[model samples]
Target: MILRAFLFLIVVWTLPAMGPWQDCEGAKACDLDGRSYHIRVPDDWDGDTALPVLLHFHGWGRQGDLIVKHQRISGHTRRRGVLLIAPNGRGRTWDFWDQGSADVPFAAAVIEDVAKRFPIDRDQIFVSGYSYGAAMAWRFACENGDGVTGLLAVSGTLRQTERCPQAPKHIRHVHGFADTVMDFPMGAGGDVTHPVALWRKALGCAAGRRLPEWQVVSFLSFERWHWDNCEGGHTVTLDLHSGGHFIPHGWIGWQLDQLMGRVPLYP
Candidate 1:
């Protein structure tokens, strides 16, 4: 008994201490290795149910904390019963321009860590971002989209790249016709529709057909297009607004509804 106790003590001393796991309450920040992310659960969540998750990335010069506090984002996630996760970029920005970026591994780590602590529906995982962060989302979807359900990108597109190994199951891209930061149509970065074109080519998607105008607000409307007939039952959509570089009101909510199948993809 004495020898057994000594051996047990030695084994215990050799084992590393468990790391902190943040709970999904009030958008608390969770740490994984040296990086950080924030998560929030719906108020009505029963704590045991496997809920859908939206992994949103913040734009350049922003952190995950700001995304959790944004009412437009957090409020919608709460109402939809979807868990929200916002990962902080390395040095306040993502390395999306590089093909071999560390951000990809960091993003994977964030998702894995969140799943370890929360009852997340892996099949319902969605990735989204804004501006530069949107570019990062595009990169992720291109490189690591095997298990992701969909991608909702706003006010940004992918950088110049020659290869995309995998295509996301679904893609919805929203941009402004008058956007100057990322520019409309094409800019210094590249064509805003570059990723869509790539997906179309990869999936052998039919030529895009214009959808009806979707009036979101009294003064704002979107001219939409959709490529429904594609290989592997994939989908691609693009929404162009008259506003500048910004996420329009009701935009995220409407996309979430479509993703959740509460609303049809087209009008």
Candidate 2:
């Protein structure tokens, strides 16, 4: 009886600690070390397959719950069989200007926690955000690029220029020509293109040449620049639209398709 009791204690001690978001469905709140976030799995997920994930950040004054419920973002992720993780910034805003900010570590912690609860495809983990959240995503990519596949930034970029320890495997940034909130070409920082240029330089892409494409749907049009030649055979794309500050319709889906190697259906 004593031996059996000792075995049980060993088993209990060896078991992994329960995560705050374990067994959660739809959009549910998750807390880690006083920080909060939210998560959603695809409705058709088999629970055994290792699925890719998208860590999407919300705009200023917005929370993770909003991102989880966003039909465009969440719907595209669900249809692509990708898990969605949205982390709430402290006070509904990200402190991403500094490379040593707390949000960077908090973001990493959230990813680690989620991986503990589910089978995640570490190689396919993507990061994205809108407006201020996009700025956060940029910073996260700069600091944690080694751990992620790529970044999809919309309507925003890094708040300031800082040396990136690692660059993401790929990057796709979409912005508007007429954006006034964050400004076009120049965002919170002097040059919105700084991150892309930095990545291009870091990855050693060929100098002064990029392929351009145009895609139009109904009344919306986009001008895209593609850099296919870079170190490690990675790609960097920048999509400029004619509209004001906002994510283009079906943009995320199209980008995801391209990343997943599926035929991109323009939307």
Candidate 3:
């Protein structure tokens, strides 16, 4: 009952903040659907206090090396020592919109398995994915947001949310305005990642209006405007002038920083 009340208070806090540091490169096993994942830890772990984690999920592709390499998440982990986890979904698609309660348990399993080795900061855990993977992350946030600090989903749309959980006080999202697969204004035309505007409304941050758009001309055009604070603090949409249905290479670290509550990035 105490745990329940604590979580209740957490949800009611309105505007809140802040998880652990762990060795993602260590010998570990992540079990899902009777399948166990053999993983490797990074070589540069300095054994610091528990750190924040970035749960990176690949879209429909079988392997995610290209997205992982181009996006350059290791750079952020190298500087901040944040634990980065990459999980492969069963079959070609995630069980996101089942409406039958499948992805929630699978998500919990993944986190639990990761925690067995690394000291995972529950409040600081984050989720990110591409295409179908992004769709799953958004769905996860709606259905089982209790497991994450925030979400950084790229190029996807929203679907089947009656089973989706509430948006926590500590949350954020992103999408390309021109995304053909998951159009920007949301609904009908796009991937159903949720209308970016409406998605931002759910965060209800008090700090956003306090800060204005201070960043300069960013390479990811769409990322520039939406991510930059407009009238309100929430920035779940992007204009993506010339961009397409891919995660722009330049913006991965910045999004990760947002997940860590504006921690300064290292050079």
Candidate 4:
């Protein structure tokens, strides 16, 4: 009995510790500029093809691992065979308010590292965010247009761009009409309409066309707008939901569809 107990204790002592730093199976933990991030590869991946990668930013007061563990975005990513990466922000919030912020370089570094370590499709790189992260996504999309193929923004508006981007990008902005947190017609950092207008102008859209209304769910109505005559085949879509102050259940799926060129008239 003493011999058996000794062996068991030895085995337990040699086992690796399960901690917050440990990533789940098929996921990796990465650090850049003293910040940490979590990268998850779809379990269903064929292990041969170069898959698209999505960099999803968390809202204020949230960490990358929390988002990876709790957010429904991962489900859509897995179904679509896309690699999902969640980055931690400085001080539990993104630093988009600063020019040439550390977050920018950290974002670039994460992409660089992920591309080097995984089978990333450079052309299909996407960035998405919620709330404060959403604002940061817009900023990155505007400034790093060459690196990111598209942007998925929710529950936040962006600051004005300093200059026009060299390439036009596809952007989908979704928000609730009754949101009190970020509030419709956004109070601080500019209203919701500003970024849409900037994107239209930056994309060189000659005109804006409103699409027909589609009711997504009970008590949830939607209105969409498309920018016409954008350069580089780029387009922008705005989805206004009747629900408020929360990420809609279907929004992530809709975003994946849009990125895959499977956008439906009603989503």
The top-ranked prediction according to TM-score is 1
For model 1, how does the per-residue alpha-carbon lDDT over 15-118 read when each residue is reduced to its tens digit?
43211333534456787898899987766766668889999989999988888877767777878878899999988999887678889889988999888877
lDDT of 3 by residue, 132-193 (tens): 87777777777676556667777764642343445533444445555787555455665333
Residue 16, candidate 3: alpha-carbon lDDT: 22
Which wins on lDDT, candidate 2 or candidate 4?
2
Q: Over the stretch 1-267, how does candidate 4's per-residue lDDT look in tens digits?
A: 999999999877654332233343234457666777887766556555788988888899987876665446776676677888898887899887655767877887888877766668988888888888887777777667666787888888665544545432688888887888876654357544454776777777767777997654466667887774687787888888777877776677676776778853222
Which run of 10 residues does model 2 get worst, by summed lDDT?
Answer: 14-23
TM-score result, candidate 2: 0.85
Tell me the lDDT of model 1 at 230. Answer: 91
Rate residue 165 of model 3 by lDDT: 41
Clash number for each model = 0, 0, 23, 0
Which segments of model 2 are wrong by more than 4 Å? 1-23, 186-195, 208-212
Q: How big is the positional error of residue 30 in model 1, measured in Å on the Cα after superposition?
A: 0.6
Two-way TM-score contest, 1 vs 4, winner: 1
Q: Could you tell me which 10 consecutive residues in candidate 4 have the lowest summed lDDT?
A: 17-26
TM-score of every prediction relative to native: 0.85, 0.85, 0.67, 0.81
Residue 157 lDDT (model 2): 79
Query: Which is superior by TM-score, 2 or 3?
Result: 2
lDDT of 2 at 42: 73
Q: What Cα-based lDDT does every candidate model obtain? A: 0.81, 0.81, 0.55, 0.72
